[model samples]
Target: MKITLFEQAAYRYLPPDFAEHHDSVCDTPYSLVTHDGMYSSMRNFLDELMFGARSGFDGIAVTEHAQSSYDLMPNPNVVAGILAYQTEQEELDVAIFPMGRSLGKTREPVRVAEEYSMLDVISGGRLVAGFPVGLSYDASLNNGIPPIDVRGRFNENLDLVLRSWQDPKPFAFNGRYSQYPQVNIWPRPLQQPPPVWLTGVGNPATMQLILKRGFGFTFFGFAGSKLTAQRIFPRFWELADEAGLEHNPYQVGFLQHIAVAETDERAEREYAEHVEYAFHTGLGAIPPQMLALPGGIDIRGVQALLRDPSDFGIYWQMRQASLRDLIDSGTVIIGSPETVADQLTDLCRQHRIGNLHALLGFGSMPRELAMRNIKLFADEVAPRLRNLWQGSGFEHHWWPERLGGTLRRNLGEKVSA
Candidate 1:
């Protein structure tokens, strides 16, 4: 039950005159006026992560998204690299940057793995690589790859990287998107094969793959509830067992948006603004037409969910409870330190969750408020949860710190510098 701070680095914009003049042009539902600048926001994020590490959080997590108001860190690897460098300077055991999107043609997965491997070597074996089969539009647009082929490409690319990492000698891979002949990747990861975590809404095939391959499975707890997670997680285990895997409970994780304040009332008040942004602007980024298709839930469905609201509701309301009717019932966890901690602990115990990815900075949340929640969670919630799994040996690590100093030094200052 190690506590971790997860940040999406949402871009929140605010200028006095632009709001009035460009309200029409700003059709997206997620943008809002915030006083903080980009660097200031990032600094605040880093400060929260540092505070989490110092206070007792096992690790800090960051993610990638693009061309939307939902998140700002389009290049999560750059942020991960910075955190790795800083963690080295401070000699902290904090693991930063666990998850990022898959690689593209221009961006090879092996190169990304090498970078993370170097970070692991430098960090003393503290890196966890989170690989995701990215959203259709983002992957297609950014990587010049079509959406239909994204999943296959993701799987193939991961296979290639894993083989490159594990294979002691030069090998050839004739993947759909990648083909190599007798070339071994340099600077192997410190954690043997390196820990890999897969993030997604709920892809059964993906879950089966992770379980079969002995990779960690992480679900974004936005669209569903703990019960839903509990249901899906066991199925993953069942599939793994069916595949003859030695059922390890440590292989499952869940992501949630969290806000903890000095008091419940204050927490609710402060978090309301972010809730509005998440539903109004965050969901508004996707065109209504795209979501209206079969098996698709449109922007209107977002509006409807916000309007009706459910306990263990959709992902949009997974953080802020004030704006909706169902507060305590849904995936969103918001309250004072004690209250939120109780909720988190209970959720984990109920679902038998091994890892909890506490998403702190999200939905246009102010950096200051986000940092406060991080500190509060680190100081209060984490210690209590640690009692649940004393002998489990569930440790968290970041890239740079995972790799020992000698390996890092051998790789040269420039490898991770």
Candidate 2:
């Protein structure tokens, strides 16, 4: 199994009653923040990411959100650029992953292409590009894009981006979402295309596109993997099969909230409140109506989700979710190193999850405790799970070549029976 640290730059000093009075996103209160608090939060978050890179993590990841209290990252590429330079300076061979900037939401697609290309160049080809269609709220509410046009905009913008990176000569792009009289990126990516990855939320069409276009599919499982993975992964692989693609595990990535300590009891005591804070103030606080606004989802998809909301798993009740509710439903894994290793290994092996984005830093977790958790996980848990897919006969096509990924094609031949 390949393990990496996935953290959001959540402002860590929200009051105890933050959830009772304010939502985590969109219209968060500025009265809750101090300038020092803002600087410290962002600084600490960056420092932690650098710490993860130097701590022997395979990769470091962050995502994009706007006007959110929990995750303050408006542009993930800026952070990715900083990581690129830092890791290159330290000679860390870790992938710099930006989960998404919402191609649909972006007005400047060429700038997006330039940033990733520069990141690849700076890191010497260590970039795993993630392009999510985007959340309804973030793209529409924050970026001011029409929810109905999001997917179409994403498709057109993505085409423009890929060609912008690969085309040796400048060319005109007549995209519905964007138009460029001359498209030529100065620094082409070091890798052929830097391993394009896409996020899918149980969308058969998205899954098919990931398989068909040879892009890696990443599933955050923020709702709770145990509750949603069985329904999602099987459906993903089934779609891959129907598309005549191999069931290559590397085609999939799953992110899970994880914490570790000397004992399961201790782990819970230390992490439970933070975990609760994460869900209650983060995903739980976002209004559901804002999440899937009409036209944000495909017409049929909206109907399917309405008829059977099981795809969302335990997300509906997350606002008042207890630690036990989170753990039982597998929204998080908090335990002794032994316990965490066992659970994570089983999850990867059973689900054939090639990439594991272990979320170590969550809502309001102090820097000290978060660092301790990272160290413990790196020392105890990561070592044990590193070889889960060693003989599984699968090549990791999703990782950067400089980090030991094989050629992107014919990966299915390695799948061990």
Candidate 3:
């Protein structure tokens, strides 16, 4: 299995103490916590990414969000640029920005895609493009579009971007939200088409689209269990088969929070504090009012479920049971390196999961703690997993290595070397 580390770039300063106070005292739709400073958080996150790269993570992941404490990477391309430059010097594939939240407005996404393509050329095509039909409220608010229209726009935007990347000559695209007469996108992605991964929350329609389009599927595993994944994965495979595409298990990626330490007890103790902060503060930032808007089933369901505390007991119980099962089934893959590796191996063997994307620095985990977890996971856990997968006929067709080398050679020693 190919292992990639995902960092949410959660602000390190959003401590549990501060979050508890906000829960009890704050009443506004948003809170400007002291830890929301951008520069320090970016610096720390960059440090962590670099640390991960040095420690031998196959890829470093970045994502996008807006006006929420869950993640602060509003412009993932900028982060990608930084990673490309850093990794170029080290001569390693740094799969940086997976641009998210570009639902429609071909101009912006096309421009961003063009820029990323240039970055890919500079980095020799190590870029991985992640597209998503973002949550209703944030997508609408940030893009100055309506919540209801986001999905349609998202679909159109993705089409335009893909066409722009693939088409050699200028073309015209007349969609509801975007109308472009000239579709000439310069600096075409170095990797023919840089790997495109679709981020979803188990939306059947989106999953079907992904399978039909032959794009990889990446899901957030925090909200569901192994059974949830099992339910979703088979449908994805069925859809892919129906779409007449090759059934490659590597095309499916799952994201989850992971923290490994010397022992399960220490890992749980350290991880629980951050997990609680994530639940209370990170998730708390999403106003109940915003979630009430119309959109995908998961968001709508979660919103409806959260409406009445009494009604949530069943959901909570299911969620708790699911989480325990995930832990037992080795789906979440947390705890000591030995235990985590054993579980990860079993999970891969059982589910035939090829890509494991681990969200390492979630919640308000301290920089030191986050770095320590990265080091331990890389040193102790990754080696064992690598050994297990070695000679197992798992394809190592990672995108970064293929595209990034071209960028390095073109930019010469100063920029790419």
Q: Which candidate number would show the highest lDDT if scored against the true structure? A: 2
Per-residue lDDT of model 1, residues 235-315, tens digit only: 677777788875444566777767788898998898877755554444433443232232233345446545654322343
Q: Output candidate 3 Cα RMSD.
A: 6.8
Compared with the true structure, model 1 gives a TM-score of: 0.79
Candidate lDDT values, in order: 0.61, 0.87, 0.64
Off by over 4 Å in 1: 14-36, 103-107, 224-227, 244-247, 287-322, 325-329, 391-417
Highest TM-score, which number? 2
What's the number of clashes in each of the models? 28, 2, 11
Per-residue CA lDDT of model 2 for 359-398, tens digit only, reads 9988888888888989999999999989988887888888
Where model 2 places Cα greater than 4 Å from the true spot, the runs are: 409-417
TM-score of each: 0.79, 0.97, 0.81
Report the candidate with higher lDDT, 2 versus 3. 2
Query: Which 10-residue window of candidate 2 scores lowest in summed lDDT?
Result: 408-417
What's model 3's overall lDDT? 0.64
Q: Which 10-residue window in model 1 sums to the lowest lDDT?
A: 408-417
**Runs with alpha carbons beyond 4 Å of true place in candidate 3:** 15-31, 35-38, 97-101, 104-107, 241-246, 284-292, 295-333, 387-417
Q: Write down the worst ten-residue block by lDDT for model 3.
A: 408-417
